[model samples]
Target: VESLSFFPAIWKGITETADALRLTVTGLSTLFKGVDLKETVSGPARIADMLGTTAVQSFSESFRTGIINMFSFLAYISISLFIMNLLPVPILDGGLILFALIELVTRKKIPPKVLYYIQFIGLAFIIALFCIGFSGDVAYFFNNFRGIQK
Candidate 1:
């Protein structure tokens, strides 16, 4: 009976995690397949702001509610990072996997110089993404600041 009691909780957690993964994948696909970049992409600052807001709202309700909300959000974030790490960007795990696949298919080791250039391009892409996200964060805060002044 004691063992049976925890089964439902475990099952629910597994199902919820799977659901979150599915949703994240779908969202990423939509974003990549021509969704409006500005509305979808947000920087670390924006994400932190959102997390702070969530924490406040959750704690305002009750201790148990707050704890649950924080855990759930953290789980979602972990899953997101896992999925993002699998994206085929040269600096990420997916890029490594992609390189391995290429080597397997061609049966030749990629040259060092080529690898350097590929990694450099990936770095540039990452920097560009950060710039875009940071700009968006700045605009968001600026607008909010103006609204408060009025």
Candidate 2:
């Protein structure tokens, strides 16, 4: 059966998604102007390490402390997901938004040829960022182990 709640629920999701995108865009703008881009972007490995650290801490702490640690970690993961999904690199929510915005302002759809080129560029950019972040994660891990070995 149809329900009014469905529309409101959709709107709520859209609203939260937009707010998350706005937050991420604000952070990126800081990077565009040379505000320590290296520290802003994080890779999958870095995220995994963070969760692993939290998991270890939870196990070693009191039940109350463990719960707090886990909940905080989960919150961080959720926010990360919200931001990541909105990134405007091809095949992502942000890319879709960008295309829609352009169509809205131009009052015409972009040609498939031009869109194809734009998408490829976005994809390349995303891959490059991933490579950089992955390397950073590797270095971070290496430094950690080196300290322990020494």
RMSD of model 2, in Å? Answer: 7.2
Clashes per candidate, residues 3 or more apart or on different chains: 0, 0
Candidate 1 lDDT tens digits, 1-150: 123368898998899999999988998889778876656778888888988888999999988788888888889988988998899999888998999999999999999899989989988988988888888888888998999999
**TM-score result, candidate 2:** 0.70
After the best TM-score superposition of candidate 2, give how far the Cα of residue 60 lies from its true spot, in angstroms. Answer: 2.3
TM-score of each candidate structure, all chains considered together: 0.90, 0.70
lDDT of 2 at 29: 76
lDDT of 2 by residue, 11-127 (tens): 965786667667766766776787644466678888888877887888787767777677656665677667767777666788889899989999999999988998889888878
Question: lDDT of all the models against the reference?
Answer: 0.87, 0.76
Write out the backbone clash pairs for model 2: none
Clashes of 2: 0
